[model samples]
Target: MIHTVRSGETLFSIAQRYNIDPNNLARINNITNPNEITVGQNLFIPLSRITSYQIKNGDTLYSIARANGILLNDLITANPQISNPNMLNVGDTINIPDVRKEIEINGYAIPSINQSILNDTLEYLTYLSPFSYQVNMDGSLSQLNDETLISSARNSGVAPIMVVTNISSEGGFDGEIAHKVFTDVTTKQSLINAIKSIVIDKNYSGVDIDFEYLLPEDRDNYTAFLRELKTELEGINKTLSVAVAPKNRDNMAGSLYQAHDYKAIGEIADRVIIMTYEWGYIYGEPQAISPYNQVDKVIAYAVTQIPSQKILMGMPNYAYDWVIPYVQGTSAKTLTNRQALRLAYENNATIMFDTLSKAPYFSYSDSDGREHVVWFDDALSIGSRLDIVTKYNLGGLSYWTINNFDSANWAIVSDTFRIKKVM
Candidate 1:
């Protein structure tokens, strides 16, 4: 049950009314300063399978529980922080836990998003990571002022992670530049120092390292860089997270896969986000961005190397429309799953679902009679992926992007599992 702060309300006062531990409430919301809350701020009053209820002129725990067809003992257990079981305050709210399970949900977004969208989504997320602050070869950090997004996340009791990438100005990760930045002494110090300053200045919860496509030989160097950064971040009470490519072995060979040492990275970073999607990429052949079979293989191997509790399986929310009889050098046009379904409806095409991949798709011929295939994730695919998280006992699920959201996805998530709120 999510609660909005009103004028003169305090965390202690709120926890008492909800019958939950004040410390637990503070920890979950990351409220370091309990006296710091202001009017209109949102605070998630977490209780399993619980719904919010307001007290009336004459209401008691026994009466409330009995009215809801719940046991008095169960109701009391759910509200441990309630000051008095017999006394009820009129206008105060309470929670009735229906059933609740804890699961983490993380999202990545850019600064261009408005506060209205953040207001809608932050309530459902555990962490809202700004797209990035690019790390330059010269050891400088590119700016991405996401103050509004950061404030929204914090206000909604969500942690806002600062993403640092080794992407160049041309808008792609560069191997040579990353190799140099990691190996050079002066430049490396400049980068780390700059990151520390930004994290402190921007009031970020943590730093998510998203350096991709480094030289395979620099695997150890990259790991060392993270180790150093972790040591520094810890001193300031900040966390360190790393994004890695999906791999099926200890060391897979490829520019994309080889540089990511899952085992070593898992040991160093507080959270390890495995980029499990992209079986079908923008330039790749038509296939599920995240096929169940492929995702299973990746998780089967990931759990062996990294602890299941820290792994966040990444999934894509969009679809791709690829022309059939594909050429090697062609790219697929991206679309939201809703858009894809709309296209199929307009063209009178039969919607198809792959039994194995558990994704939805359809084939249609355009005006010129060119056949094309559209594949994307819908509620079913999202639900199946959620199953993977529970089956493996993994930490949670991550969206490579929340820029293009599907309403079906959030509804499925809320219906399936209780989200773990960690501010």
Candidate 2:
């Protein structure tokens, strides 16, 4: 079990709510100053079904266990720290362990989602990151009515990570805008200040910086910005997560993929979310959204740079349908994972998985005699990808967007792994 701090909640109050000792709570989470916890911070309870119970003035291990419907032996075993239960301090916190390790699950959400969707999906997330707060050159941010998502996530025991991106409201990621903020000292500080203000005002547990298509010249500047933000957020116990495009090599050159400097980012940010998807994209050739071979290669190189424990492999929750005889400038249409399956069924298309890519894809001709190819991830493919997490000892999985409810994906994910909760 984990607990997310809410407004006006202090370490003592949270400890009492969970029936844990304040000292134990603080100790487990490395809270040097128990009073310094901010709203939205995730506190790992280190317990699952069993809540921690504080020893009262007249409490005995037997009495405590009996009262909580636990066996005395189990209680004693779980609270080994209490060598002499009879002489326990009034506020001694004891663990009641029926524990199962839960993997962290981070999902990205957009502002347009309704309350119903939020309610339905919060249970499956460890963190719900809003799609973005677009940054302006002057360090200003686009406002969003994200209160609903934040409140719902907090209520559901899921931490909300505010996503700050370099994308322009008018369109996609702007390289010039990224360059301006990264290279201009004044604008960069202003952007950091703006991000900090929004984080505080929104009670965000952390910030996910997704600056893409950066100019190679701004690489050092980008690292510096992350370091500063990490230090600032660290002072207040807030987290910093950075999202980088997939690359198989450190020196791989491209505007979109370069300048990420994964090693530097991994050293600074608390989490480095590697977007391992998009081999098949809106404007790309028909292929698996995340080709296993590519993703594996990316992971192999990333682990050599960043600590595997800090990496959250990014997975695409959607698919793409591309027109055959692929034209240079033509873009493929998008679809949800379920939608892709429905299309395959309607067309009687025989699905096949590429051995090299380890992605499932198929082809069919439309009424207009136009050939199309569909590549997407289903339960089987998703499961295989998730297996890589355990294989690589990575932090967890980060879904690019969880707006569409793919029950198959969720079901398989849940069945395969338990999710950590901070409520």
Candidate 3:
């Protein structure tokens, strides 16, 4: 359950009302300071229910349970404070337990991610993919310093997945390099062998291929590469996961979408992470990174080709602050979700929710007297995205990056679902 902090409410008071230990409540919600909770902040109550209901006049436990379609005994078990069920009380709240579904969660972290942040995130993840090992044209890999991350993931019972991408040092995905590796059988074999060696040498449970930007003509070639890679990984008892661009239809015209071949890739890989975010990018116009409407279109099309159980919808943990009157070639400054929240508070900006996009945004002026708009994900937005998983019966969720810890995201996720641990 998620509880919004009202005026003059302390963490202890909230815990007392829920009949939970103050320390346990704090730890579950990742609240470092019990007194620092502010009004309008959402805190997880660690209950099984979706929400709590207040007892009103003529309300009995049995009536309430029946109204909620729950067994009376189950309701009683959820609320232990009501010592006398026969007696009626007004204005008292009781726990309402909602059955939580089990789901798998995958997170990507940079090699240089802070150790403390990784530790806090590992507890909720089933797989951790370090971003990334750059795949070269000659099939030789540019290494990432992922040893520490892999060790930590194993210790925390999270599967460490090796991520291979065609991202060059010059920046961004290199389409030419991907074309060379995909079309040339020799180079493709070498790349597969290199990937296998690393997966075994590093004791990775699987590999995540995140190649992007390829020639439209090489679509079949790309699919063949994934098919071979999947075979080799499976031979060694490992898994293969691919990250593809968000597209709503076959033969999507963009270079990013054309070579993805969602149907073929889904059939080849163990898991497919449909990158549902990034409609609003750094250089793009200001908007929600993963608007529910656009993301829904992608998922609706994705399920038509890919098996629902093999799809892992993408989630973004970052936010963009764009200058007003955005220029086409200009870039927006990237901020972590938590950083965005702090910026809003420091700027005295009143955050507003967009009902159409199902996103949160705010506007503020900078020291230079320049206006800016910041769009980010809050608990409500996160919940809306997670609902897609339940609605589509997806395999689970794959976070684009998890280098930063957002308490609200974890709070809602932890309280609403039982995280499945494959390790």
**C-alpha local distance difference test of each model:** 0.82, 0.81, 0.87
Shift of residue 35 alpha carbon in model 1, Å: 51
The local distance difference test score of model 3 is: 0.87
Off by over 4 Å in 2: 1-101
Q: Give the winner by TM-score: 1 or 3.
A: 3
Give lDDT for model 1: 0.82
User: Which pairs of residues have clashing backbones in candidate 2?
Assistant: 1-47, 19-52, 21-93
lDDT of 1 by residue, 170-287 (tens): 9999888789888899999999899899889989999999988889999999989999999999999999989999888876888888889888999999899999899988898999
User: Which digits, one per residue and each the tens of the lDDT, describe model 2 over residues 375-419?
Assistant: 887555776788788788888889878887766566566755788
For residue 196, model 3's alpha carbon misses the true position, in angstroms, by 0.8
Total backbone clashes of candidate 2, pairs 3 or more residues apart or in separate chains? 3
Residue 79 in model 2: lDDT: 78
Q: Each model's TM-score, in the order given?
A: 0.78, 0.76, 0.84
- Select the stronger candidate by TM-score from 1 and 2: 1
Q: Candidate 3 at 179: error in angstroms?
A: 1.0
Root mean square deviation (Cα) for candidate 1:
12.4
